[model samples]
Target chain A: MADALLETRALTAGYGEMQVLRDISLAVQPAEIVAIVGSNGAGKTTLLRAISRLIPCGGEVTFDGKSVSHATADEVFGSGLVQVPEGRQLFDRMSVEENLRMGAYRRGDRRAIDDDLDRMYTLFPRLSDRRRQLAGSMSGGEQQMCAMARALMARPRLMMVDEMSLGLAPVIVDQLLETMTAIRKEGVTVLLVEQDVHAALSVADRGYVMETGEIVREGSARELESDPEVQRAYLGEV
Target chain B: MELLAQVLVGGVLLGGLYALMALGLALVWGVLNIVNLSHGALIMLGAYATYYLFTGTGLDPFAALPITAIVLFVIGWLIQRGILNLVIRGPMFNTLLITFGIEVILTYLAQLLFSADFRAINPPYAGNNFRVLGITIPLMQVLAFAIAIGLTVAMWLFLLHTRVGRGIRAASQNLVAARLYGVNPRSIYALTFGIGSALAGVAGGLYGTVSQINPYIGGPLTAKSFAIAIIGGLENPLGVIVGGLVLGIVESLTALYAGSTYRDVASFGVLILVLILRPTGLLGRTT
Candidate 1:
């Protein structure tokens, strides 16, 4: 088996006194696309947040062989684990290009950044056309594209995307899934949290089923797709 | 017509100084999201540093600028690291209160050390003036104005071209992503505040050559800096310069036509109107 790029061992976290994640353990292999599917408030987003060190967490979160559980959010990011948060979170007043440039803020590789930017522009040609436009003015789908591209600009070893399909139209969602598959093919590992079970499983190499903040089941995407329990509970069919 | 031209030139020159005065406040507000009430006190400290240097060692105020900036930078760094950092991650109101407390402490300390005597730095060429286009302008005012604009431009260039400047800007935009860049926010916060205070100090030193300094001057200077920052917007560095010039011209026209006492009233009234009508100053895009 390929080495895990990221590993979470019995991880637990929550806001204030409310425990949201209860001993959730997971791992992502290098260059693999892993998807976590769950109902709303099942601690999927919270899990990503904890792994990124945005919130205080417990147990072990190791990225690239470094302990990230006690690390600050910024430290976690410095270790090449980047998160495209639930909301687009683009700086609304900034131009689209400026927002993308901000993603490479920690990096000094100007040549590489420029190359990545050109690649992003090619991936989302609409963004290239509206490069100078304010991010807030863009349509929802356009903003999502910008957010994903911005995260890519970081040249992350592991990218965590939360609710990539949220509030997006079906067509846009399909396009985004295609982009995610393409990104995975580029040798970048991805950890995707999604409500769109069918769409997620279609592109995901492996799938984890989460319920009430715990990983209830894990298997190959094909296995989970045909599982009776997954069909009844998440696929909305018997 | 000559009087109008003279006032216009004077207003423009004064506006440059005003821009320098507001630059630090705008930087602190823009980057650190801290409205430093003690900003004027740092400016006051800069003036005192210049005054003492000139009186003791006879160094020219302009030449002594770097010294004042360094001293003020140290002071700002210590304040941020020791006092301000504790409450920085808390509510905005906490920051305001802590900075206000700092203002009071600095003011009382200045009063004890410097006294309330109004002081000015008079170099050998202090009384010199030159006529340009039939309008008389002081040599010191021209020099101060040039230095002010020069420093402001340099600051803009630094932020745009340098890695550290980008880090500061990134931190202002998103703290988490800024950290991903390997920027220790605690140090960045201190460095930004230090740079802001250093700018204030330079402004204060230049101001001493052009105006009077007392412990009481800090309050009004703070108010003027705040007005300039709001009028300029927090997003762009160049906006402060435009905001300063606008206020300077307005104050000059109001003082000439209305009265001297109406200067603050006019400047602050315009600030209020701008906030009400368009809160994001000229260069700032509404968020």
Candidate 2:
């Protein structure tokens, strides 16, 4: 726990006067896939936003053993905590290759950056075919792949993916889940936030169940997947 | 027929300068989403900076352009970082009011410092004109046109190819996503505003070589720039050229046919027509 790659203590955030998250604490160890699953409006997205420093939050967020609670969003990202925000926010007018280049914006190693570009192309072969194509023109599934690939180009130590499976076909979601597992194997820790509890727990090493801005349960992925209450409420089983 | 051709030639040259004038405005509006009312004042400052450099040090007005641009860029950077960034995320009207206030303050400062007299950068060749194919062309207009086009192309290439340019583009499109790539919005916004101001300054310097400059010039010039940006649309980098040419030709034709006093009427009329017919601009995507 002391070596957790990302840790938040009593994290709370909200829009002006409308609190969305409350006293939520979580941790992701190095190279592990930690999933936070809940239904709609369970503050899953808010938690990710708070961790990324996109929105103001109360409580402590420590990444790589540094207190990033007061760090700006760019500073957080610069220190290798990156996020593929909800809704695949690709630069709509830029080419797919340009979008990938933006990922390594802070890096100055020209040759290494180029090598990473090639790796991204190989990782997401579909992106290679449409390198010159505008990012906004891609299908939802392809855009999702591009988003993940874009984040990977940053060479992040911790990648927080928000709603990766949102609005995608089941098969595409499965493919993306496999990609997340492959990413973890590359030694990058993941904090996956999802609304689809079943899909999230299937690939997570450990899981936390959120309900209305609070962690209702915490256990190993297998236990959460089989929890009677979790199954009845989230898995749509009796 | 000969007179008409002469007017067309003059219009084309004038249009090129107009394109450069609107380029800065378009960049700020398109990227920072700040419809900078102070743009013309920035342009006016550039003209004065060039004027001072010429009168004070005997530097050629054209040669003083880079100096003027740098001065304007720093002023712009400070203005954004020190003032505009605070209210940037607030209501659009707040920025509008603040920029308008800046324009007023700059105009009064220029008047107080430089006097209300009209100043012209009369380089030795200011009155030199040459006739080609029965069409007369001023030497200064040609030089201004060439420089304007060159800068416009340079800006387009910078936005398309450079790393900082890419950051500006990405930041403009999505601030949150840009942050994920280590883009600091506060600094990026200030940088963008600085670039926009520098372009405006360059355009002002060019304008001084070809015409008279006074403290009151900012208002009409800002209006013209708005017309050009709106007519051209903010979608493409080069669209300003088309918009400028349209306005220049329309103004030239109006001046010849309906007298010089009607030129403003003609330009604004075209602006209204463009707004009604195609609000996105000539090259703007319909979607």
Candidate 3:
């Protein structure tokens, strides 16, 4: 728990009078792929938003031993807690290369930024071929890849990806999961919020099952996969 | 035929200045989503600032542009950060009311301080004219046109090349996403309004050299700026040039053919036509 890169204590958040997240507590260790899987409107996105400080939340969010609950979104991002938001929110009018450059907006080291750019192209080869293309013009799979690459350019210590598999083909989702594993192998912690319970747990080291704004179950990926309640509610397997 | 050629040339020159006038309004409207009804007031302030610098300090009006731009930039930054940002998230109507209020306050302030006397910046070379291809061109108008075009192009490049410029564009498209990439929306919004006001300042300085300036000129100038911005489209910065040119030429042609009294009729008529035909402006792509 002390070594956890990201930990939330009784986090609660909502929009206006409508509360979405209720006392949700979760932790992600360094270099680990942790998934928070749930159905639609289960507060997975709101939890991610709360952690990233995009929305106001109660309780505490600690990142890398520092309390960041009240930190502004810019501070959270600058502290290397980055998020690849849902819906592949790419700057539609800007070119693919520009989007990646924006990801490195906070970095001052020019040489390192360029090196990271090259690394991103190598990681997502399709992006290299379409560097000049507008981000919005790309296919959904390609856009998602670009979004992931854009976040990586920031050289974050921990990256939170929300709904990465949304509106994508199954094969594309598998490829993305492989990319997430590879990203974790490079010593970056990942908090993946996904609706696909089976796919998320397969690659995640540990998983939490969220239902209706609260975490109902939490365990190792293998344990969650074997749990009959989780299978019955999410995996469609009884 | 010679008269028509002369009028067209004059219109083109006027169009260049018009482009510069609308550039600031377009930038602010496009990025900040604040239509900035006070934009012309800022322009009026710029013109008065230049007028005073020329008369009081003996500085050339052209040389006074940067100073005016900086002054207006500060004022704009303060206005946005101090007033507009508070109600920015409330409703679009609040911004409209606040900006309009600013415009009225500025107009009254100018009237009390500078008086309603019409002033012009007349350098010794003001009356100098050059003849080319059987058409006479006033040196001051040409210089204003050249500076206008230069500033407009520079603004376009700044938006394309600089980090802050990219931040403005990114913030305009999506504030939440831009914040995720380490952009502070409040500061960026303030900086963008400042830049837009600076452009307006430069345009106002150029306007002083070419025409007469008065405190009441702000309203008409703001209306003209809106016309140009709409004709050019809000999406592209360079669209202001085309929009400016269209309005200038239309006005000149109307003055020459339908008499000077119908100039507004022609310009606004074209605006109505553009609105009916292409709601996105000339360069804006249909969504």
Candidate 4:
């Protein structure tokens, strides 16, 4: 309860004429890794977009005691709720370095930004070699890494990453998950939405299973993993 | 040989000026996906602004560039905020219609205010020419070309390096990501249109120094700008240089070999060929 940094209560959002997310309520605690696991069209991505204010949403969204119900996407990020959107939407024409710089697009602390740049290069050394290359020229794995690094540059308190493991090698996924663990270690809360149920539960502190625009089950990651129904439905362990 | 060199030089200079003319339109086209039909009319207004600044205040045309740019920037900002913003999210055809209407209105306003008479900005250095490497270059033309190229480079650097510039570039790709970066869309949209207009103002001012301007010149100028933008690719600001130089040299050679009357035919012919061949433009991305 003390760590509840972000809370969405009875949130409802959808596209024109059709509702994708219905009465969704979720909360992320300080420095915790919360994973939302679901299949395609389960409204996991919609939940994140609703929280980030990308689409029109109803119900109250609060981040660190501030209301963001009517806030713009920029204001949400400004309030320290940043999202790495689904698919690596990297600025294709911009250089890798420039893309990373854009991550701090709202920050005014010049000295801290330079320090973060060094830290990013250190974490993902592969990016250092391709710093001058256009982001579009990078492989999927590299672009994913760049996207994460760019989001990190925002220095957000709560980082929401969508489809992090999509179109990447297993090794890259493991590496990225490991990086996420390290980021969580830095005391930044993370909300990860993924379709890979096994990998997501394996890494998350807690997990929520979404089905058809509703949270069917939510508990500690270990409890959810051990739950017979989840094992049968998601992990195919029947 | 000297005549050939002179034509090449003149063509390159003219191309630089042409690039400046197209730069603003290309910017609005690339970012907002709005093919601003009124872009040339904005340029026409810029030329008049520069003209009046010179005639009324005795300010040097080149020196009045900042003023002209500011004035045009405000005009563009208002147009976007007042008019374009309302229908920005609407269909592309509607946007085209609206911009065409803007073009007509601007043309009529310029005609009413400045009259239908042709005007030129003839500073003291307008008639001066210098020989560079055995080829003669008009000083005014040289200055215009230099400033044009300089501004393009500056724009490229700004979009590449600066925060607002990067935000604009990011917004161009996906407004969602840009918004995640704290970009206020309405204001940023206004700012982008303003910057585009500012660039047009500088180009118009430069054009005034080298050519005759009247209310009716906007349509042809707008057509030429489209050709350059299509040829140059909108991916990078520097692409305009390639587009401008190609059109400039082609027009220059056409005027030399074919006849001055055939310049428009050659320009439009190349444009059509490029459209038929590489629709994404030479420098634009294939995908």
Candidate 5:
């Protein structure tokens, strides 16, 4: 198995001519939860977008020992590198269950899909009862859970989540985080982008702090959490 | 009361054929996001194809359906890959314009070839009818309705169950996510357009059996198809049936009570009301 489930070497991507992600390099090892922390507009979402091939990018992105730099978003998805996009971009018109089914659009195995759906319901019991409800009608927290569960339905080897804690109550965020940790335990490598430094670092094994489209600092989560500079700058502490 | 019931039954039967006529246009619009102004023209062509097959080759129109579908599929595929794909990435208006252009070209060509003469496919069984509950139903109309509903169901199943169907749905929902599903956007797009065209062709073939068709019919049929798609909502295939039935009944009742000239006005008025009051459509969720 490749040491890094996903790696970006000198990755640069942007919308049109304005580069939002400069020459950047990062790696996510198998079975590790890596967190990227940055302020708003720090290119955290842009990085995920580039990695998932949603935007035109120039750089080497390799997944499972294969170069993904030239791969289309569908090709990247087919290779098992799935992303739960920001703002929970579920098909609002579809039922929650239908949205979940759409996540597994690439899979041909109906039996496995049923099994995974059952597992998703077990992980988010609230979703089970509301499966028939329109995804747009669900509460913000429930929508987030549905988004995460939908991504899981794809059976991805590496799952990228952008801003899981955004617009959620603290208790719901905690529950989501716990569910994410459980997902990682199932051997899926997770690369999380978050503005919540403390919450992210608590679950992450390693952390990278980004600023102005570049990684400004990297350390073990524990080290970064304790670093006075990081605490003062990113964690909102003196 | 009996007269009203009989009229309603007739309207429903006619509605079934209307649903079939609109099905292909609806599929193309809903899945491919192409309004396909040429849709009715393509249906006209399908009817012509069936007409020639029956008259020239002595083949049953039903038996020749596969051939018509395949030929139309190829034509649709070429149009998508050649003309449609060029503007597929551009504005929605571009598609509308190009398709309208195609419709004009096809209508002119059809007129030149078919001589602007109205044609209908009348088989040996054309006059047969079956009566139920004192309401008489034409066999052809019943068959057309059955086939229309059947095709709609099949389309729904294909989208839900088949790989290509899922790919088309994926492309419609999120192009980026669709790529992740390993579907080449260009080919999938062409394939979707082709399928839509094939459906249009099938609807056209069935239409020839029940009604007179000419190149001029394309305009009104196109308008009706658009109304059906809009009223039904583009999100689900079954929406077309509901939209078709509503339109069919309204048109029938208007023709009977308000004078035949008011039918078009009523259909257009209902369309306007739906647009102003519920743009997402009757079945679609309001955004």
Candidate 6:
């Protein structure tokens, strides 16, 4: 709690006249993989949106000890709190290389940016192979890789990824989760949202069960996985 | 046969400039999603700016293009920041109505300040012509065409290579993700509009050398520009060039064979045909 890099308290957010998040609160510490698992319409994406300031929210959001509650998405990102949004929102018209270049949009260190690009290419060989192709032309799995690599270009301190496994093959999802662990080991904190309870809990050091809009249960990964209620509700195990 | 070759040459020259004229509109619509009904008005203002520079400062219209473009860029930035930015996310209808109002106001102001009289930028080389392969090419038309193609290529390169250009493309694709990359949408939007207006200014400068311009030309010019942009699609700058050339050839051929009175009929007829046949333009991929 003392080393919390990103924290949200009493965060309430929604579209106009329709409140979706009610008194939600959570946090991610440095160099940790935290997952939020929930079902459809469970406000998982909305929480990420609120933290990134894509939508208006009422709460206290602090990143690295700065108030990010009212910050715009760019400002939030500037403060090292970034999100690889759901749906792999790559610039479809742009080439894969260009899309990756866009990830390092704010940084001015030319040599480092180039190095990061090389590093990303190494991490995702498929992307490197299809660097000249349009982002839209790639398959869904390739797009997700590009999206993650693009986010990594920002060198985010707190990276929040929404729906890591959505619409991806089980094998690709496993590969991506392994990469997430490696990313965490490299000192970047991660907050992930996913619908796959088993996969989400497997990689996460800490996990939260989100229902409707509020955090219903919060504990270590083991606690959430072993709980009868969580297993019945989310995990397929009877 | 000679006359037909000359007409075809003339159409090619005119079409190059026409593509330039529609490019700024395409950019604004493509990135900012603003229809920019006042695009032609901005072009008109640029022509007036070039005209004044030529008339008052004795500067050649072609040489004074950068000055006109820079001035229009500033004006465009202001318009986006102060006026259009307020209602940018409100509704497409709101932007359309606002730009339409701006068009009317700009036209009226031009009439008030510069008078309703038509003006042409007739410089030293204005009357010069050269014969290439038995076709007479007006010096001004050739210069305008060259500059138009050059600028279009330059714009394409800038968008493809520059950091700001990448940001604009990203923002257009996904505003939320663009923000995560540290792009301020408001400023980026303004920058896009500014670039669009600057292109319009350059186009206007070129247009003044080829034909006459007045305050009231904005409406028809805007309509023509929109038609070309639709035909070209906003996918690539060269596509616009193709669209402009196609429209230009059709108009010239129609004028020669169907009479000048049927020029609009031919141009708009192609517009209708493209709309019915391929709404995404010839080059634009279906999404």
Model 2: per-residue Cα lDDT over B185-259, one tens digit each: 888888889999999999999999999999989988888999999988886668899899999999999999999
Of the candidates numbered 4 and 5, which has the greater lDDT value?
4
**Candidate 4 deviant stretches above 4 angstroms:** A1-3, B132-135
Using DockQ, give the best candidate's number: 6
Backbone clashes per model, in order?
1, 0, 0, 0, 2, 0
**lDDT minimum window of 10 residues, candidate 4 chain A:** A1-10
lDDT of 1 by residue, B132-239 (tens): 888899999999999999999999888766768867877887676556435678988999999999999999999999998987777788889999999889878888
TM-score of each: 0.94, 0.98, 0.98, 0.96, 0.92, 0.97
Q: Is model 1 an incorrect, acceptable, medium or high docking prediction?
A: acceptable
List the pairs of residues colliding in candidate 6. none
Q: For all candidates listed, what's the TM-score of chain B alone?
A: 0.98, 0.97, 0.98, 0.98, 0.96, 0.97
Residues A39-117, candidate 6: write the lDDT tens digits.
9899999999998998999979888988988788898888888789999888898888888888889889989999998
RMSD of every candidate to native, in Å, equals 2.2, 1.3, 1.2, 1.7, 2.6, 1.4
Model 6, global lDDT? 0.90
When sorted by TM-score, best at the front, the candidate numbers are 3, 2, 6, 4, 1, 5
For residues A1-238, write the lDDT of model 4, one tens digit per residue: 5458999889999999899888888889999999999899999999998998889998888899888999888889888898999987888878899889989988999999999999999999999999999898899999999999999999999999999999889999999999999999999889999999988888899999999999989999999999999998889998
Off by over 4 Å in 1: B176-184, B280-287
Better of 1 and 5 by DockQ: 1
State residue B199's C-alpha deviation in candidate 1, in Å. 1.3
* DockQ-sorted candidate list, best first: 6, 2, 3, 4, 1, 5
lDDT of 6 by residue, B98-164 (tens): 9999999999999999999989999987999988888888899999999998999898888878999
Candidate 6 error regions (>4 Å)? none
lDDT against the true structure, each candidate: 0.88, 0.92, 0.92, 0.91, 0.86, 0.90
Candidate 5 residues lying further than 4 Å off, grouped into runs, are B1-6, B132-135, B160-170, B173-188, B257-262
